[model samples]
Target: MISINNLTFEIGARALYDEANWHIKPGDKAGLIGANGAGKSTLLKLIVGDYAPTSGSISMAKDLKIGYLNQDLLSYHSDKSILHVAMEAFERQNQLHTEIEKLLLKLETDYSDDILNKLSDKQMEFEALDGYSIEFRAHEILAGLGFSEEEQKRPLATFSGGWRMRVMLARILLQTPDILLLDEPTNHLDLPSIKWLETYLQAFEGAIVIVSHDRYFLDRIINKTVESRKGKLTIYAGNYTFYLEEKSLREEIQSNQFKNQQAKIKQEERLIERFRSKASKAKMVQSRIKALDRMEKVDEVDDDNPEVNFSFKFSKPSGRHVVTMENISKSYPNLEILKNTDALIEKGDKIALIGANGKGKSTLLRIVADADNDYEGTSTKGHNVSQTFFAQHQLEALHLENSILQELVAFAPKHTETELRSILGCFLFTGDDVFKKIKVLSGGEKSRVALAKALTADANFLVLDEPTNHLDMASVNILIQALQQYEGTFIVVSHDRYFLENVANKIWYIEDKKIKEYPGTYQEYEAWSAKRVVKAEEPAVKKVKEEPKKVKAAPTEDNKRLLQKKNKELAALEEKIAQQEILVKDLEVELAKEEIYSDAVKLQDHTRRYNSEKASFDKLQADWENLAEEIMELEG
Candidate 1:
């Protein structure tokens, strides 16, 4: 647990926090949220002792372990494999394993009671640390974070900056520290990887404090919300949705109070001015003036809302089918990512391309956009279907030496300077900001510029990949609104669920080297996928029952061996079932703890895990019984 008391942190002329008090208890999962440069990341740094407070103090248990994932990717040894870097999280466990190996070597030569005792102690420590499963868990985590088995074996230097950041995140997750401070953990993750992180954090036993722009991620994982604004911290006892509702109400009430106080002060001032020249009401005037002096002025709330307004202009309308692809296939030298995939994009269809990382979503988008024409496919753009493609690295493609104004002028040289400045202002860049060089802009600013250029390109179709990666919540909302109002067909590959839910009317799910189109929103697509999973499992259950009825021959020697194998498997399954049951019981006990139950999100997660473990135990028990019956019949 960590506590901050009257924490005051300032940087030069700006005070980010002033006499702020906050406490993060054990099992607390809080989302730190605010606009860009609103001190969310600064608070994380303060907690990690990287930034000392200007006044007051931050206190925590001396033995508390903290793990922090910074926005920037950490540097790793070039020669070390990605897996090797991740396994460093379990340094102590790995050391114990090494000690165990050395002791075994010693025992082979000359063993003594003292040496044997030491080996026993080390083995116990290793087992307690779950050393046997460390490698497997490490690999599983790496795979979840989008690292292939081959990629895991590759040296860290071979990965891109985004992949390197994922490796850093994996290491922090594996550390399982008492407290986790994550800044933009989902910035580099795809939708599937983000979901994996959500599930993993749900099961984490410690506290979490994360600063992320992904609203859907925060809603699923965080139980509490802490907002930083105007040198103050406000805590919400619920998730992002709850915070929004509460903040709205609070803002309305505060606005009303401020207006009423201003009105009363104005009336008193008028009375004082009028009566100051008259002796008939000297006492009342003095008293009113005293009250005015004693009154605390309510500071007006600053409007932090982003004002973005823009519309796409096209030269001409496209055909009913914006794009069509037949038997599209793409392959690299080492791997085939897409195989005979077919897709159709109709006019005005807003499609969200979603899948796991490296699953060819971007490749398919590129193919459709004509950015890459080497793929084997019959890809054709419909008549008058002018298109603009915004890749994930589109911002990086901007000329760093050019000013923001110059960048837009380069895109549309025919537009007047006044018109260009007006367009820039619509995207939240105005006056001096328009003159700032592209190299000096932040990631969000650069993304806005790129998007502004794309929207103004006079194209009827847009192919955008990961356009929301570096955008903050406000910018993402603005982009969503802009895209919604555009009268053009577009295909977007993004991991922001909130953005997708608002802007996308269709879902193009990429899996197993194929594209499946679903005519619904992202939430509806999720429901459809869940139903498909359930339907798929039903057939497996039915096949398991039907297979036993078809066996009619007497047991042979091979059957005996199979039966023995089944028996051993059954025994192992039963042991696993017992262990799982114990875990479920322990979780139940944890659920009974007052602190755990008080937090609704944490309680729901525990209950869900308990049910899941219970279900697995039941399935294993059923398998054991089925095997037992099969063995008995064979024996007879």
Candidate 2:
């Protein structure tokens, strides 16, 4: 548990936090959210004591352990295997293991009772700490984070930066500290790994503070939302969805109060001026002036979600079909990305390419973009097609010597300074910000510049790879809006489901070295994917043949009547069960709404209704199952 008391932290002239207070209690799951420059990551570092506050203090519960997973861990390397690296979290157990080994070696020589007793004590402690199974636990976590058993045996230095980050995440998880501080842990993960981490974090008993741009991850894992804005921390009682709703309501109320206070102040000011010359009202005017001076002014609400007003339209539209690939096969040593797979991308397609890391989503993207000619494939672009490819690596393509404005201006000579600046404004580079050199910009800022340049292309089809990387939620939303408004074909690879759901109309994934398409929105794809899993688990219904005639005569007729009655009952109960299911769902949704949460009585009432409906639905399901089994018995 940690408490931040009136924390005021500054960097030179700018205050990143001003009198911000937040209490991270045991078992609390909090999502730290804000725009790019709001110091979300800085707050995390301050909590971990990596940075000291300019004023005020941060206190933590004594002897509390903390496990932190951050991007900086990408630089960490060791000759030890990933499994060994992860198992290093068990410090006491590892020390005990070494001592036990020494004792066993000594026993082989001396065979003394003292050494035997020491060995016994060490073994007892090891077993108590579950030391022997630490390797298994480490392997399981590594695998969940997208490492193979064979890969886990490989040295940590052999992996890339992203993979190394996953290894660090595994180590932190193995540590199982009292509080876990994760900064964009989902950035390196694919969909499956993200889901695995979500499940693992949900079951984690310790407090968690996560600063992630992935709102989908925040919605699922964090129960509390903390918005870092204007040097202050605002807490939301629920997840991201609830925060959005509650924030809108709060802004509205604050806006009205601010308006009312302004009106009242104006009225009092007039009265003060009118009575200033009159001796009889001097005391009253003095009191009013003092009251007005001492009044705490309400700050106006800030619009965090800025609109992308700049229009982005390519000059040309491609033919109906965009990209076609046939007989595609890509192999790298022991791995095959695609094997004789065919893919078709038509015009007006907004595709979200997703899946695990090793699935070769990037390989397919390269093939589509004509960036890789080494793979075995027949790839063709549509007639009159013009395309632009955007990736994180493209950030380096920008002219560091040039300002943001100069970079775009040189890239698109056809567009005037006014037009270029307009686009830059949409990318959050307004006025003097456009004069900032590309070399001085943050990663997220440079990413925005690169994205803006990509949109300025005269191309009709766009290929984007993890475009949301290094971007805050606001910038991601801007990209989403720009893409949504653009009437062109594009395919983007991203693990941010919320962005994918909003910007993409089709979902594509790699399976068996083939590109697979799901012709629906991300939410629909999620539902269908889950339903497919459920369907796979369902038992196949066995067709019951006509009941074989039994030797019993009087009982047979009664059995037929009983079976018929039960069949009717089952049908009726099923119909009722279907309606009850809807009722329960409606009540559940109602209970989750912001309005219900704002009112205790409404929440309680809706919860009671939901529970009652759920209980009745369960009872109906039970009755149906029992009756169906009886009817089956009667049939036999």
Candidate 3:
């Protein structure tokens, strides 16, 4: 647990936090969020004692253990194996083992009482530490992070940056510290590995604080939200989606209050002015003047909202078909990344291209975009179907000294200066902002400028790679709205589930060296994938042929069939017990409502019924486990 009180952190003239009070209770799973440079990370560091606040204090639990994983600290040495690095988490246990070995050597040389006593104490300590399980835990974590048995033993130096990140994640998970501080933890994780992490966190006994841009990850993992903005922290009691709705509503209320106060002040001023202008009402005028002087001014609430507006429009195409890809195959030396992949893009199709990293998602996009025309594919555009590829690396395209407006003008359509300025205004780059040199702009600003140029191209087909990376939620939503209203084909690669759910009409999942398409939204794809994963984890059943029944079928047959039915019923009862735990919690909360309190007798009855059901369920679960053991032994 950590507590922050009246904290105000600042650097130079800028205030990151002002008189902020924040806390993370024990076992709390919280998502920290804000626009870029909002001090979310700074607050985390303050809690960890890495940075001192400008004023106030941070209090943490005594002897508390913490594990932190920042995005850039994922470097791994080439010589160390993945398993070797993960095993280092249990260095204490390893040291104990070494001591035990030394004690064994000492015991062999002498049978002295001191040697025997030391060896006995060493053995006890080793067993208490669960030293034997250290290797098992390392393997489990490495595999969970997607490292195969052979790959785990491979030198870490041979792996790329993404794999190195995975190794770092494995090490952190294996450490199992009391509190986890993860910043963009899912950046290097594939879908399956992310799911594995979700399960691990659900069962973890400690606390978690995550900073992520992935909305679905926040929704599934976090129970609370901490947002930093305008030199303050705002706490919300739910997931990312819930926080968004509540924050918007709160902002609207603040805006309304400010408007009402301004109107009341104007009315009071008018009354005071009229009274002062009348010579016959001199006393009243003096009284009004005193009242105005004594009146406490209602200060307008500051706008903490960070919404960036963006608009994009494209020219209507001459035809319906946007792009067509046939037999796309890409390979590097001995590795065939893509094999005979084909896809067709029709007008107005909002497609999401997704996959595990390195599974040819980007390669497939490049093939479609015709960046690598040497691929074994024929990609064609329909008549008047102009296409544009907005790479994630578009910031590298801008040269030094070109103003933002000038850069766009070079690629923008021939139009009046007023028309170009109006287009720039839609994206929040107006007046003075338009004159800033492109080389001086921030990552997000450059992204918006790149987007403006793409729109100005009037391309009917847009292929975007990670378009939502630098944009904040407001800008992302604006882009989504524009895309929804646009009459063009769109293909985008993104990790933001909420954005994909809102914009994608279909999903193309690249997995296991192939591309597969799912009809419907991201939620549908998740649901479908969940069923597959659950089924795979389930025990496989092998059907046996039924014995032919005679008029007086063997008496043993009836007994065997009845026993099987009983076993199935027992299993169902055990499952019911697991379900009831969740159901009882819900009912307990529901029965405490005011409406239920109005009927005390009914509430008492329901409570008693729930208690009875729970007792029976628990007893059934115990019996089921015993019966399963007996059945397994008998069958063997």
Candidate 4:
């Protein structure tokens, strides 16, 4: 849908993209990956027209629409509710609906052939665009991005910055443009939300170009990979895994080629130096010089510099049971998040806490860490268990006035300056970076500083909440390695499946106000969950088929009682289905109204209720039919 030809973009003196060429065809799901400063976001901005290329051009197909979601939150229309803002994505659909309504009113007031013809045309146009389902689809997109039924009604200003970004994402997804450009789309999402987005993108009928640090998300949603390095773009034909392997092989081959050419050049230069004064070898010397001059020099492959290497060291080991929670019940006002949940964290256990947003994953983590004592639970720390909790907003606790070096030193006052500097270096802060004030650092940089300070806190147990939110791939890899080597118990709440799969040995899933412990890696848990879902669904189908057999056997008192009960159920089911169908119809009518669609919260609630009622109505109608057949056979 979009094409970049010889695109050269620069920021001041530094050239980010030099003569880079890339093509995004229709339905292409491409992942844009690079190191932290490799201009992945900048490339996205270039495509979205936020940045103009210094040279060359980017061209798009005629009349193509584009949806761009940047890392920052979009603050326009902040007074509107989340649902209302998201519904705005369907501007064309809304406009068509308005025109259709106007035409209907005109036809009703003054009947004429022209009015009738215009009304018919508008109705056809509306149906062609599926305008009737606009509000429903908008709600689905918002809910998938982690907005609750109640929260969808609240104004955008009420939500945190992270959640506001999710609203922006929902808007972009609902737009359904010809092409999508997303930068770090999953940075603010929980595990369930990420999974929902993954499913949504998998079925999206548009070309997608995403710049993200999430390896697993990329693997699941993208079919192609575009990598940026040293002002050039390289395309890989497969997913993130394929890109990694292919890039490695290409780099190795290039390194060898460069080495061979260097060897040949040295040999030629040596021969030229020796034969310069020899008159007998003049022709050979000239030939070799010409060959050397004509040969194109192969550029040496540049390896990634500033590789972060560090390991966590516990000051002391905790007891076998590092932390324990029993009979835990947490509630806020009318809502009960967790109830009677029990968990045990043994020494050296790496646990990943996962759940949908607002399902209390972070709450449970905080309760165990003693960060929040306002809960009905018995949580205890084992002997000699020194705990450090890294909240999602822990970076805010850092002194913004202090430099990176000052922050680390404050965490470990006794450590020498050189020791602290070495630790900061391991976190990718080195030389001038260490002296940079924390206030000017970006969110990712602040996260790095906070993590570096936490590693020096000498704690044997850690409770981390979304620790990898702002980390790049390399930084996340480093943290995974360090945490793997740490001889301590830790519970982490993270959405990065790749990071969790590498670090977690146990998965604690929270859903329906209960915590289920799965003693396996994340991949294994996924497999188990899939099987469980299938097994749970099998018995429902079997029961429906088997129940009718008993009613057809004989006409005893027990059988008669059963038959009467079935008849009563059938009548009730018919009434219920009728009522639900009416509700569904009413909801559809309400959704078609401009006033209702403009109110986001109402749209979401009505949409959900409509879907729920429609599903129940269908199931009840099927059961009623089956029971009616059974009654007829029994009476005969």
- lDDT for every model? 0.85, 0.88, 0.76, 0.83
lDDT of 1 by residue, 1-636 (tens): 898999999899889898989999987889999988788888888888888999999999999999999964555546799898899999999899999999999999777998899999999999999999998989999999988888899988888778899999998888889888999998888877998898778767788999999999998778889998877889999889989899888888888889999999888888899999999899999999888888888866555565556645777999999898999888999879878988899998999999877778878888988888898879998988999999757877999999999999999876778877877777678789899999988888898899889888889999998888778787787788789889989999998999999999999977778888999999999999989986774423335556656546677998889888877886787677668777877986886554665465777787788888878877876876787677667655
By TM-score: ranked, best first: 1, 2, 4, 3
Candidate 3, residues 1-636: lDDT per residue as tens digits? 788899999899988899998888765778999876788777778887889988999888799888888865665465888788878888788888898899888878899998899888878887898988888999998888888898999988888877888888888888888889998887777777887887676545567899887777887767789888788788998778889799788877877877887787688778878777678988877886787678766545553443433344565664767777777677888668867777778877899998766677788788778787767767787778878899867778876589877887788757446667776776667789889998888787788788767766777888888887677665666567667766778899887778889899999976555667898898899899889986774322211114343354333665677668767875686577668766776766655443442233555565676677768766765776676665544443
Task: Please write out the lDDT profile of model 2 over residues 1-636, one tens digit for every residue.
Answer: 799999999999999999999998775789999989899989989988999999999999789999988788888979999899999999999999999999988988988889999999999999999999999899899989999989989999999898999999999999989899999999889999999998687656678999999998988778789999999999998999989999999999999999999999999999999999999999999999999999999988878888776576677778998999899998999888899989899999999998889889898898899999988869999888999999899998988999999998888888889999889888888879999999999999999999999999887899999999999988899999999988889999999898999998999998766788999999999999999896773322222234455564344787878877887887787678778877887886775455654444555576667668888888877776777788767766
Model 1 segments more than 4 A misplaced: 276-290, 306-309, 413-423, 544-612, 615-636
Instruction: Decide which is better by TM-score, 2 or 4.
Output: 2
> C-alpha displacement of 278 in model 4, angstroms?
6.8
Deviation (Å) of 306 in candidate 3: 8.5
What is the TM-score of candidate 3? 0.80
TM-score of each: 0.87, 0.84, 0.80, 0.83
lDDT at residue 554 of model 3 (Cα atoms): 39
Question: Whole-model lDDT, candidate 4?
Answer: 0.83
Instruction: Per model, state how many residue pairs clash.
Output: 0, 0, 1, 0
Runs in model 4 lying further than 4 Å from the true structure: 103-109, 112-114, 148-153, 269-295, 305-309, 414-419, 430-432, 539-636
Q: Select the stronger candidate by TM-score from 3 and 4.
A: 4
Candidate 2 regions with alpha-carbon error over 4 angstroms: 268-291, 537-636
Give the winner by TM-score: 1 or 2.
1
Off by over 4 Å in 3: 75-78, 101-116, 277-318, 413-431, 511-513, 534-539, 542-636
